[model samples]
Target: MPDKTEKDQTQVPFGELLRNFVIELIVYGILIAIYFYVALRFLANPLAALFGNNLAAYAVISLGLIVVQAVFLEFVTSLLFDYLGLHRLSSRPGKH
Candidate 1:
């Protein structure tokens, strides 16, 4: 058996990495913006009513939406990265 070396692995160019980072930022921002837009326009009043003017409930709901937005962005960006080959497959040897 032969030992694999890190030097054998492929690397992306710095420019491509920077470009990908920018793209990721824009995508995440868009997702979060959509979340806030929908939550504020549609959910805020109804939730405020349901909780009877409790500010804490709105805070909790806002935090939950943030978490959900982050998770959704992560899932979507991961899929896009995989499809676009912006990142390497984790199943590759020595990736861990």
Candidate 2:
């Protein structure tokens, strides 16, 4: 029976799914951490030295940097998925 066939399909364990999701979250967290570390460690001092002290300006600059970092992360993750051969199957050609 179709119902029996469907019922026989393998199911992912809940713990395995949770573990995968957690791992992905930790990976993304580390990426964000590296972004902030690089920003503060390498760029912040030079930027402050060049631009002078203005809290509002620094805040705006930091916000822009965060947005850029997030976009960069998305692109990097897409590349990684492709490189790892784990890119999700497409329903249509040239569509992610």
Candidate 3:
């Protein structure tokens, strides 16, 4: 005789789980592409203009700008997720 709970369970396909993971990865990749586009297109030129003819200073300034843009991108992505109703459990994984 089988247990009632066992009999009542419905099996979810592993393909669905794999597909979900893949889709999430794809979304993250798109976000990364956006980050780089914003960083280079909007950030680099102004930073270069600020430190004209100085390769070292321009590199350092651009690096700082990149960091700031990365943080800004993460915030925008989080806001987007919340707007889409996919609330994040934590900003940093495994911290909770």
Instruction: Give the poorly placed runs of model 1, Cα more than 4 Å off.
Output: 1-8, 53-71, 89-96
> Top model by lDDT, which number?
1
Q: Which pairs in model 1 have colliding backbones?
A: none
- Candidate 1, residues 7-67, lDDT tens digits: the string is 5366667687678777877876887688779866797679769578787877798789889
lDDT of 3 by residue, 1-96 (tens): 944332323343557545655665678789778866975678667766777778898878778867987798788767655554344322323322
Per-candidate RMSD vs. true structure?
5.4, 8.7, 9.8
| Model 2: lDDT of residue 16 | 60
Better of 1 and 3 by TM-score: 1
Each model's TM-score, in the order given?
A: 0.55, 0.46, 0.42
RMSD of 3: 9.8
Colliding pairs, model 2: none
